[model samples]
Target: MSAGAPPVVTEIARPWWDALARGEVAVQSCSSCAGWVFYPRPFCPSCGGRDLAWRTVDPAATLYTWTVAEAPVSPHFAHLHRPVLAVAELGIGVRVPTTLVHADPDDVRIGMALTPVFDAGTYPGFTLLRYRPA
Candidate 1:
């Protein structure tokens, strides 16, 4: 099998992805309710507001949880050696699911400070957002 495929950039998420390409991590914020949103949606989940805007936020986050992948579930992941997958809660209260890189699985702990790692070389035309100890 081939390496993992890149994410498809949709119209709704283009700004967020574009920001990532520029080495800036951004999330959607509701203009009406001032709520933070992830996964890129047309409306705000907090107040069901249609007025939403992309906002740059601090890349710092707290590792909420994580798991280690010892074996490749697919050929795309064969290159990864015991990759650590983590869910981190950003400073803005958004929980982002991302890979934890440049870290030992054994050393990772809950509540550890993490910062964003944008892998622009991994996938052409797209940047893979990972995290590392801060």
Candidate 2:
């Protein structure tokens, strides 16, 4: 495989890759309410506090919901459609909508458990977190 150009990583998420490079989950945790947040942010979602800090969360999460995309929404994704799909609800309380890999589309269901599988994309050369049935 040929190496390709890297994708443009946003400034807000660059720290996430730095943490992943160390094999650690750099999720934001609330200092006021102690609620763990997935998408790294500067404030607490539960308490609206600005004293949030990076903390490690269990890579484990339950599948709260899911959806099968069935249709090609993007030109780049059209060729990858072997029953291409999207899954939702990751982590304990965090909800993330993303692509599902290594699983059959017919096998997807709501409220199924899932875990994280990290990948450094071939063309984009960036970290991707894929969910798996747990």
TM-score for each candidate, following the candidate numbering: 0.93, 0.76
Q: Superposing all C-alpha atoms, what RMSD in Å does each candidate have to the true structure?
A: 1.8, 3.1
The residue ranges of model 1 lying beyond 4 angstroms of the native Cα positions read: none
Q: Write the per-residue lDDT of candidate 1 for residues 1-134, one digit (tens) a residue.
A: 13587688899999988998999889999999898989899999889999988899888899999999989867889988898989989988899889998899989999999988988877778887889998
Give the alpha carbon lDDT tens digit for every residue of 97-132 in model 2: 555667676786777767676656545446656677
CA shift at 134, candidate 1, in angstroms?
1.5
Model 1 score (lDDT): 0.88
lDDT of 2 at 46: 72
User: Best TM-score goes to which candidate?
Assistant: 1
Candidate 1, residue 110: Cα displacement in angstroms equals 0.7
The best candidate in terms of lDDT: 1
